[model samples]
Target chain A: MIEFRMPSLGADMEAGTLREWKVKPGDTVERGDIIADVETMKGIIEIEVFDAGVVEQLLVKEDEKVPVGTVMALIRPAGETAAPKPAERHVYETFKSIVNVKEEIPPVPAPAHEGLRASPLARRIAAENHLDLTTVQGSGEGGAITREDVEKAIAERDIRLKPRPAEPAPTPAASTENIRMAVAAAMSKSNREIPHYYLETSIDMSKALAWLAGANRQRPVAKRLLPVVLLIKATAKALREFPDLNAVWENGLQRKAEINIGFVISLRTGGLIVPAIRNADKKSPDDLMETLTDLIPRARALKLRSSELSESTITLTSLGDDGADAVFGVIYPPQVAIVGFGGIREQPVAENGLIGVRPVLRATLAGDHRATDGLTGSRFLAALQQLLQQPETL
Target chain B: MTEADIKTTIFQLLKRIAPDTEPSTLGPTDNIRDTLGIDSFDALQFIIALNEKLGIEIPEQDYGKTGTLEQLIAYIKTKER
Candidate 1:
């Protein structure tokens, strides 16, 4: 039997509420199959299972909030005839819970005759919000209370207590503010702990844009590539050479082999999310453009998968089109470096003989000083510049 | 498609790209991107959606010709023939 647990979606996620289950007992599941939708601070993310088996039991019910690493289910390996019975499974779960104190055991419901029949989730939320269970109306089978019942009670109570007019049911602004707060907490933690060193360089983008324009002239709008794709590929290729900068700082530097670049996509509402384009170095510019185009809309809608949010080795931020001349970013925690690209601008440049106007891009690197120094950052920038100058090679 | 049909379809596609914007508020001759506050990515998305909805390929050079609602309708009408 294998245990399926809640995954840590990012450094910011502490716990996630099991919004819905896509699998049930006796259903066969393969690796990478989405098993549940989990609602975290980041939003509802489709959680993928990493084990191939028949699901034996679901320990947590829908709407139950559980911490990271809390086992939500057990999977019986394929071709197993005799799965654990309910009695044996109960003993096993009891033993496991004894060993893992953080795993919250559901409160045993009272006998139906006495009072207050509610699911464990309803009870927990009521206790947390200081709501009286006696006042809540049950909406489940046999009038058993569920999480939705308690939530409705809370909303009604809020409406009653407040003197203002009726507020909308779904508060997009409130959720946006929650995202902003989460971002603030992560960035503050990054600022507090990471010892950051900054580096910047200006690269002339005349050759790159010329190549892109000539190349795009033949392709349709849907298939044409963006300059950001070239930047991402160049950054990933540069990281292949400068291994020190493409690492995460745990207790020490943990260098990653795959170049997963977390490209930051800002939402129109307010905050931003960085989702990884996995194995960016291995992908051609066309593939990079396709992946980026697919990710941007999903990222804006807060519909990213858990792996895409969690697996980035390095972060890349580009101020596209309308932003300032340069961007010195803060290094995200665990990530040792962040690469930033400023908007491409037309400026006077001294070429071989005379000064002329050329499109210039200012690229910045924020590196964790504990993992790498300024020299390593400088070389990485140089490599990025060299790669961009020959866009056909990328 | 007639001009009215093309205009409605274009507004619907723009609504998909920028879900928060009110497409009916846009004027006929106003710049679609700047008035809607959509960036280059969104502009590209709008173009792709137009192709999917109208079954027409918009070239890079013709992007300037389709800058407003009236112009986009006219461009799509010409292509519809």
Candidate 2:
């Protein structure tokens, strides 16, 4: 049997609460099927199973918060037997005990609420209102507290303390605060550890934009390409020439063969998420645009998969239409470099011995000094500029 | 379609693109995209959806002209003729 553990969604994530299970004990699941909805500091993320197998057992209960690498389920391999052997069960039992022993003690006394059962929603409501679960009586199966019971308790309490202004309803700010904290933690760790070096360059977008407008004129609005797709493709192609910039510094510089570009999508509420467009180097500009169009909505909805969150070799942040002239991004570790693109604007340019107006874009790179120096970064930017000038090749 | 029908259709399309938007709260002259916080990608999506549902083709140059609610309604009504 293969152990299915809780995956660390990002470098900042330490634990995630199992919100709901999409599979049962005997369900057959394929790779990339979303098996559970996990609640992390970021938001509710649908967890995808990486291995195709027949699920043997679900070890963790719903609403249980567990740390990274904690085994939550067991799956029998696709070609394996129908059930685990007796010896395997014994080994599983021993492993469970060892894990249980290492768990931290709860803030509440364990004996007080022993054998007490409450619905997940009721438990959440109680915690939000600071109402003790032991005090609220359950009216569910086996006398477990239902959501109504918690609501009734809250109502009664509100009546007892009437004449005061009603308490404000819970807002999305709480979750946004959680996301802000996660971003702060990751960025602080980045600033504290990584030796950052900054580089900036400007590329004229006359040829690229002209080609794009002509290309878009024949297409429908749904299929029309955006300039950001060209930027992503050019960055990916440039990485092919400069291998060191496409590496992560984990103990040593480990260059990744596949180019997974983590494009940053800012949420409407607040904060941002970087979800990867896998194998960006191999995708055409149209394909990249489609992937980006789908990715932005899903990232905003917080419905990203596990691998999309964890498997990015490099990150890209673009300050679209209304942003500043240039942006220098912080490198998200263990990824060694981040590329930033500013808004494209018309500016006076002296090119080919003539001064004229052309659309110009400022591109910036922030690299970890330990993994690469200024020369490699300059070459990468130069290559990126060269690649953009010939948009048809991309 | 009548002007009222166009208004209703536009609001429905807007709601689908940005779920949090409140139609009653928006001023007629206010920029729909700016007030609703719809970015460039979503704006393009909104336009595409409008084209599919209303059978009105909005060109790239005219995208900026349809920013406000009244402007979009008037534009679509003229096209429906």
Candidate 3:
């Protein structure tokens, strides 16, 4: 039996509430099937199972928040015979003790004023009326207080106290604050743990941009490629030569087998998410663009699959459109390196005695010093520059 | 299709690509990216959606021409004819 644990979606995610189960006990699941929806501060993400098996048991119930690596379910591997009853009992007893150990470590108690299950609107209404949320009865799902409940409470209170004018309700700020905290925790951990080495290079993109314009002129807008696509492709291609940069630094450097490039996309609300473009090196420019177009929408909507969230071998961040001259990204942990691209701008260039204004892009690499040195990072950047120069090949 | 019909169709397409956009606030001359806050990816999806819906192919060279709602509608109207 293989235990399916709650996979860490990102460095920031410590725990996730198992919102819903797409599969039940005794259900046969295939690899890549979304087995559950996990609610994190980011949003509800569909968690995909990596192993194909029959779900032997559901260890964690829906709506229970579990820490990363906590076993959520047990899967019986396909073609494996059921264990004898006595053997099963022995396994169950061991599992029970493991769970008991977890239970022994008491969780941080919720604050007195914050533990009540009240909606933001309800909380606001109760606060405006000087009503305590714990005293207000909830009528919504999971016995959470709704706006109607607050209104009902207000109506009952109005009979005893003088009616006051209702103030405009405060907007919900929990999600934004939560995201900020998550980002803070992750960045702090990265800074404290990872010994980072930063490298930056300016690449002349006049040829690449010109080539792109000419190439795009022939294709329909739907099939048109962007410079970012080329950047991703070049980065992926370069990783093949400098595999050290495309690795995670745990106790030792663990080089990733596939080149999965994570692209950081900033959400409209607040914060950002790095979702991977799986097997980016294998995709054509058109295919990469299509995947990117599809990925961005789903990512913003919080509909990204678990694999997209977790399977990045290295990260690529671009502030090109945002007009940043350069970016030095904090390496997301486990993943040792992050490549950043700045806006392409026309700059004076002297090439072999010829001087002209050309579009230049600043690319930066932040790698774990333990995993790779500056020479390796520089070589990777050099390869990337060469790839961008030959845009047709990308 | 009439210009009004084209505009309506474009709005529907934009709504699909950017569901968070408030249609009431959108103006004819407003830049979709600036007004609706959609990135280049969403912009490409919008172009793809228009192509699929109207059976018209928009060249990448004309991307600048379709910056505003009015420009996009006008471009589509001309293409439909």
lDDT (CA) for every model shown?
Answer: 0.78, 0.78, 0.75
Better of 1 and 2 by lDDT: 1
- Highest TM-score against the true fold, candidate: 2
Q: Taking the tens digit of each residue's C-alpha lDDT, what string does model 1 give over A1-394? A: 5556676543455666778999999899887787888675666667776556798878767776777655577777666668433211121221112100011223333223356688888877876654556567799998888999999998875553343332233266766765785677568767878899999999999999999988888887688877888999999998999998888887799999999998988777888888999999999999998898889988877777867887889999998866789999998777899999999999999878999999999999999999999999999999999999999999
Best candidate (score: lDDT): 1
Query: What is the full ranking by TM-score, best candidate first?
Result: 2, 1, 3
Report how closely model 1 matches the true complex, as a DockQ value.
0.31
**Can you tell me the CAPRI class of model 2?**
acceptable
TM-score of chain A, every prediction, order shown: 0.64, 0.63, 0.64
Q: What tens-digit string does per-residue lDDT give for candidate 2 at A1-394?
A: 6656676544555777777899999999887787887676755566776567788878667776777655577777688775453211111211111010012112222225467688878877776654556667778889888999989987875553333332233256655666676677667768878899999999999999988998889998789888899999999999998889888887799999889999998877888888998889999999998998889888876667767876788999998866789999998878899999999999999978999998999999999999999999999999999999999999
Measured against the true two-chain complex, the DockQ scores of the candidates, in the order shown, are 0.31, 0.39, 0.30
Compose the digit string of candidate 2's lDDT tens values, residues B2-79: 777888888888888777677656688999877887777888888899989988889887887788988988888888
Model 3 misplacement above 4 A:
A1-39, A42-62, A65-181, A320-322, B1-4, B55-57, B70-81
Model 2 scores a C-alpha lDDT of 0.78
Residue-level lDDT of model 3, residues A248-296, one tens digit each, is 7766998999999989987767787789998999998888988987888
Interface RMSD of each: 1.9, 1.2, 2.3
Off by over 4 Å in 1: A1-38, A43-62, A65-175, B1-3, B28-30, B54-57, B62-65, B70-81
